[model samples]
Target: MEFGVSTFITDEGIGAADLGRALEERDFDALFIAEHTHIPASRETPYPGGGELPRIYYRTLDPFVALTAVAAVTERLVVATGIALVIERDPITTAKEVASLDLISGGRMVFGVGAGWNREEMRNHGTDPATRGALMDERIRAMREIWTAETAEFHGEYVDFDPIYAWPKPVQQPHPPIYVGGESERAIARVAEYGGGWLPRGNVENLGDLVAKVRDRAGWRVPVTVYAARRDPAVIESYAAAGVDRTLFFLPTQPRDETLRTLDEFTELAKRHT
Candidate 1:
């Protein structure tokens, strides 16, 4: 399995261009960044990972903007959104952004999407939390139409548009690879319906079984990418053996030197498995 790095690119951390260059120089396969438009102060949604949410969540730079910077500085490293909240974004603008980035990066873009956990954040974007799954499905379908059709149009409960022109099409033919993120059965169903790949959060105890389940449900082999994977070589090796296509080690938003050191450590650990 190939290895990559995923992090929340915050205002106070290592810059995107620098991180991208560093990852490419180290022979890493990709660079994935997380996204959060803005954190609601009401604190209604509990952190998925538990306890207080990290400061980086509130200070993250726009994923497309940050990945564009990464694309500008590196050639081989895949630039991706670890999980762009589809429910929170307008499909037309997002489609343009994805296509433009894919063009700018010479087709090195992987669009990772999720329904999202923060209800308040989705509500703020005029998205109803109860129907986010259906909303996400329609939005993704709409974006796909926008990316591929000569005269794109979509009419759905959540997303609708008339036949219009969107340019630069995308360097990756029809569009960039869409990796749906989540661990639930419903999430897997969505991946089967539309995604090119699956992005499951954290280390899964029964990863091999999960991969088998995805294949059985999707009726085809679906590539699996595990995010926030442990930096242990044994753990990575186990995942590789379990049929994970890529494993992205999570990096904390830290100063350049410290971040680079951590990258070096992870790289060394990954080398053992490769």
Candidate 2:
């Protein structure tokens, strides 16, 4: 099982290029950052992790831009979005962004995506929360078409386009892996139907059975990657037993040395299992 770190990557935190080089130097497997295009002033959606939502959520740097900076400095570290809001972006433009990043990073992008939670935030982007899932699905399907075809065309409720030539195909064959996030049944189905892997938010429930069910239903053995945000080595082993392929440890702060210390500690702890 590979070990990685998930950080906020906000404007105040360690810069992307610095963090990327640090993670690589530490021998970490990957570095991931979460996304929120912009947080609304309204506080309707309570943070899943509790307490006041940290500044990082509102202060996050754009994932693609940040990842690009990281990619420029690192040779082997996997740079990824812990979760990109697919419901609020254009599929064609995003496809091009993913392809360009993959080429720049030598195919080391993991396109983690989610429908998002804040209704007001989605509304700001002109996306209705009621249809976020459907929109997300269509956007992903359209992205796949763009990445895999020389001249791609797609027609769906949320994404429709005529055949057009898109250039700089991703370095990884068929494009970098698209990992779907969230725990809903629909989320699992979406991953099985279109994604390269299942990215489950860390929770107490045993997802082994659900993972098996999704794979069986899809007829494709997609790997499961656990967020493992606060889980210990024992818990990680349990996830491995449950067939998890990779685990990401969450770090919500920005202090470079402090975060790096945590990474070193987790790296040592994770080495026991590897």
lDDT, candidates in the order shown: 0.91, 0.85
Which stretches of candidate 1 lie above 4 Å from their native place?
none
Model 2 residue 10 lDDT?
84
Write one digit per residue (lDDT tens) for candidate 1, span 196-230: 89998766678888888988899988988899998
Instruction: Give the alpha carbon lDDT tens digit for every residue of 151-218 in model 2.
Output: 99998877889999997789998789988888788887787788888888667587788778768877
- List where candidate 2 sits over 4 angstroms from the true fold: none
Question: Number of clashing residue pairs in every model?
Answer: 0, 0
